[model samples]
Target chain A: MDISSGVTETTIKSKKTVKKQKITKGNMTPYLFILPSFILIVGFLFYPIGTVFYYSLQHYDVAAPFYNGFAGLDNFVTIFTQDKMFLPSLLNSLKWVVTEVGLQLIFGMILALLLNQTFKLRGMARAVAFIPWAISGVLASSMWSLIFNEHMGVLNDLLMKLGLINEPQAFLASTTTAFTSVILAELWRGIPFFAITLLASLQSIPVDLYEAAKVDGASRWKTFIYVILPQLKNTIVLTTLLRVVWEFNNVDLLFNLTGGGPAHSTTTLTMYIADLAVHGSNFGYGSALTVITFAILLLFAIVYLKLSRYEKE
Target chain B: MIFNNKKADKLITLYLPLSMMLCFTIFPLYWTINTAFKPEGDIIKRPLQYLPANPTIDNFVNAWTNIGFATFFKNSLIVGVATVIVVLICSTLSGYALARYQFKGKRGFMLMLLCTQFIPRAMMIIPLFIIFKNLGLISNPLSLIITYSAVEIPFTTILMSGFISGVPKELEEAAMMDGCTKLQSLRYVVFPLLLPGIVATGVFTFIYTWNEFLIALMLTNQQNKFTLPVGLASMMGEFNVNYGALAAGSVIALIPAILLFAYAQKHLVNGMGGAVKG
Candidate 1:
C-alpha cells in the first residue's frame, strides 16, 4: 500500500501504449477473432438468460406441457402468495452464504498467512493443502458422507472409543447437523480457493513495508494492522464479494448430499429452485424462483460493488 | 538470537497451522483413496482400519464395470477435451482482441464479462433445458459442450487477456515488422511464449468441464450420456448405497482433475496472481 502501487505504475507504462491504439489501426481482426465467442455467448448464454426472464412469465411445466402458455405475473404472484418453501429456502440461502463465506474467509486467511512465511517444505505443504480445490462439489459431498455415515463412520468410531457416545449418530439425517455437516464438507473444498487467491495477493505485498515496520519497532499485530491489511484491502474485498456470490448460488453439494433434506432444513434458494426444475416439473414456478434468486444475487452484487467501490476496477 | 527468534516465530505462525490445515485438506482425499482399495467387508468392519487391510481392486472394478463409471469417465473425458479446445480457441482469440486492440464497446464487452460471473446457474437451467429439449439435443453431448464453452468463455477470455497482455506486444510487432504476416508472426513468435498460459487456461477449462454437475445433470438423461459427476451422483442415490464403489467412483472422477491440476497448478497460481494484480 505504501509504495507498491507507485512501483507497478512505471512497470505498466507499456500497457498504457497498447491501450491507446486506434480502432482503425487494428481494423476487423479483433472483431473476427471475437465473433465466435460472441456468437456462442449470445446464442447459448444470453439467450438462455433471456428465456429465464421470459419463462418466468409463462406456464412452462414440462410434465403438463399441453397447459403451458402465457402465465403473465401469475408465477411471481404465486411465489409470493402460495410458495411456502420460497421464503424459508431464501433464508437458508442467506444463512449458507454468510456462514460458508465467513468461515472460508477466516480459515483461508489463516492458511494463507501461515503458508506465506518462508519455511522448510513450504512448497510441498502448499501443494498438499491446495489439493481439495480440485475436487468437485458432488465428489466432496460423497467423500464427507462416508465420514459422516451413521454406521462405520470414522467420527462415530472415534466418538464411541472416547466414550462420547454409545452408538452411531446419523449426522446428515438429523436436521440439527445436516446443514452444518454439508457446510463442513464444503469448507474442506472452499477454503483452498480463498487460500490460493489470498496467498497469491499476499505474495505481491512488498517486503519493504515489513522491514520498515520492523525498524519502527512495531509489534506484529500493529504491523499487520498498519501495513499488511491496508495493502490487502482490495483483494479481501473483491474475494469476499466473489465468495459471497458463489456461496449464495452454489447448490451442487446440497443437492447431492441432503437433497434439501430430512426437514428441508438445508434447502437453499438455488437448491429449492433446482429441486423444482429437476424433480417437480414446475418449470414456471422454478423459473419464477430463478428470477427471484437472480434478483437477490443481483441486488447483493450491486450493493457489494457499491460498498467496495470495486465496479470502478 | 534474531535468527533463532525468526525460526521460533515461523514455527508458531506457519508450520504448525499449515500442517493442521493440510491434514484437513488431504484427509477426505486420503480416506477416498484408502476406501477405494478396501474390501467392502473391511470398509464396514468394526474397529475401523486406517490402513486398508487386504486391499483389493474390486471397488474400482465394480465402479468401472458394474456401476458404469467407465462410460461416465469416457463421457467426461470427451466433454472436457472438447470444451477445452473450444474455450482455448475462442478465449485466446477474444483475449488477444481485448489485450492488443482498441475498439468501440470494448469497455462494454469487458463489463459484460464481469457481469457474467454473477449470473446464477439456476436461471440458466430452465431455459437451457427448454432450448436444448426443443433442439432435440437434450441427451446430446453437443449440448453440454456448447453450453460449457459459452458459460466458460467470459472468464476464460478475461484470463486469456491477462495472459496475452503479459506477453509484450513489441515482440509481436517486431515479428510483424521483420516481413512476417500477422498470423505468421503470431504463429512463430507469440504462440511459443503463450503456450504455458494457454495450457494453464486450457487446464482450468478442462477441470470445469470435467467437474461440472448441475448443467450436466440437467442436459443428460441417458446413462451413457452421464458425465462423471452425474454418474457418481446417480450411484449415490441407490438404496443400499454401495460405499466401496461410490468411493471408487469418486476416486476415478478425482484422477483426471487432480492430475491435470497437479500439472498446471503452478501456472494457475501465477495466472491467478496476475489476474488479481491487474
Candidate 2:
C-alpha cells in the first residue's frame, strides 16, 4: 500500500529483483571458499581415520610384510587378550591424564587469579608466565632434562647444598619417582595452558560481581566459592575436556625424556600405540590398537560431554 | 587502615608468590640459555656457577655446523611457513563463509569442526604414515606441510570465523554499495581489518608445525629431512646425548617461537577468548 503508486513501485521492484539475482549468484561463493579446507581435512584427517579402521581389519606390517591380509577381529582380539603392555599402558594413560589435568587446573587457576590482580609489572609478569606455553613439547622436554640430569642437574645441586639428601638420588631412575618426574615436567608446561585459558575467562567476569560480594561482606573464600566458581564452571568443564583429550594423545615428553623408561613404567597408551606404529612393524596390530584407541577416546568424549551436560542441566 | 592492609597484603600476596612462581617459570628457560653459552668443563662442575664464568658460543657453533641443526632449522622453517600459508588461506576463506553465509548444513559444518578437536593425534599417525608411504611422501617436506595444514585447519577456521564475525557485516556491504565486488571488499576492506586475527592464527599455526614432534618423527626417515624437534629428539635418544650441543640446539629452536609468541601474545589471548565464545 505504501509503494507510492506504479511509477515508484517499478524502480523498487527492479532493485529488489537485482538484489535477488546478486544473492543467487553469490550462493556458490561459500562452497567455493570452503573447497580447499574441505579437501585437506577430508583427505588428511577424515580419510586417515577411515583407513585406520580399514587397516585394522587387514593384516599389515611394514617390517614383517610376510603377515599381511584380512585380519577380521584378530588384531583387536590380541590387544585385549594377549598384549601385556595394553593393560599397564592403559593404566599409565589414566594416571598421566588424571594427575596432569588435575594439577594443571589447580595451579593454573591460582596463577590466573594471581596474574589477574591489579599490580605493577603485571604485563611483564603475564608475558613471562606464558612463555612456556609457547615452546614445543620437545623443547620443554629438553629444558627439563637438563635440570633433571643426576650428575649435572641444578636440582640435585640445590638439594645437596640445602642438605636435603645424603647423595644425588636419581629421581627419574626409580619406578616410584619416574612418573612423578614426568608429571612435574609436563605440569610446568601444562600449567600455562590452564593459566592462559582460565585467565581469559577470569578477565571476562564483571568486576561489579566482586564489588557486590565485597559490599555484602563475604570472606575471600566465600567470595570465590560463591562468585568465581559458578562463573568459571563452563570454561573449566570445556577446557578440562580439551586438556584431557590433548594430554591423552601427547607422547613426546615420555618418548624423549625416558623413552617410555627404565621398566616400561611411564608408557602411556599413546606412547604404546606410537611405539607399535614406529618400531613394532605390526601394522594390522598397530592399526587395531589405533582403532581401540579411537574407541576409548570416542567413549570418553561422549561420556564426558554427556556427564558435563547432564550436570549443567 | 585499608592502605596499611594493602601494603602488608601486597608483600605476602602479590610480591612474594609472584616472584616465586615467576622464578620457577623462568629458571628452566634461564638454565637452557645459560647452558647454551657455557663450555663443556663448566657445565658439570661440582660447585655450579649460577652464572657462566666462561661463556662461549662454541656450543652454538658446534650445534649449528657440526650437529646438523642448520639443516633441521631450514626444514622446520620450510614446513612451518608452508603450513601457515596454506592454513591461513584455507581457514580465512572458510571462516568468512561461516561468518557471513547461511548455507545448508552450516551447523553440521561447525559441528564437524568441533568434532575434529577430539580426533586422537596418536591414531592419526597410523593411517597418515600408511597414506604417506603409499604416496611416496614419507620423507618429503610435502607430507608434513599437507598434514600440518589439515591438522591446523579446523581450529584455525573456528578461530578465523570468530574473528570474521567480530567484523561488522555492514563494512563489507558498504564497500559493495560503493561498487566494489565482494572479492574486492574482502581483499581491500576486510583483509586490513582481519590482519591482526590472521597474524594471531598464523603465528599459532607456525609454532605448532615448528614444534610438533611425533608426526615429524614418524613421517621422515631420512636424517636430512628432520625438523628441529625430530632432530632434537634423535639427539636426546642418542647414547652420548651431548648436553652442551643439545642445549644449544634447543635454544636455537626456541628463538622464533618465543619471539613470535611475544609479539602476538595479546592477540593470541583475544583470539582464544573469541574462539571459545563463538
The best candidate in terms of DockQ: 2
Residues A1-313 of candidate 1 have per-residue lDDT tens digits of 8599887897697567755555345877888989999999889988889888888899888788998999999999998988899899889998999999999998998988888887778788878888888889989988988899998678788789999989899999899989999999988889988889889988988999999999999998999888988888888888888888888878988998899998999998989888887888988778888888888888887888787785445
- Badly placed stretches (over 4 Å) of model 2 are A1-23, B1-3
Clashing pairs in 2: none
Question: Candidate 2 lDDT, tens digit per residue, A1-313?
Answer: 5657876889989889978966897679888989899999989999999988999998887776777888899988988899999999999999999999999999999899899999988999999999999988999999999998887788888889999987886777879878988999999999888888888888899999999999999998899999999998988988998999999999989988887876999999999889888877887888888888888888998899899899888
- Interface RMSDs of the predictions, in order, are 1.0, 1.0
DockQ of 1: 0.78
DockQ of candidate 2 (2 decimals):
0.82
lDDT of 2 by residue, B144-165 (tens): 9999999999999999988899
Backbone clashes in model 1, listed as residue pairs: none
Model 2, residue A44: distance off in Å is 0.3
Docking class of 2: high
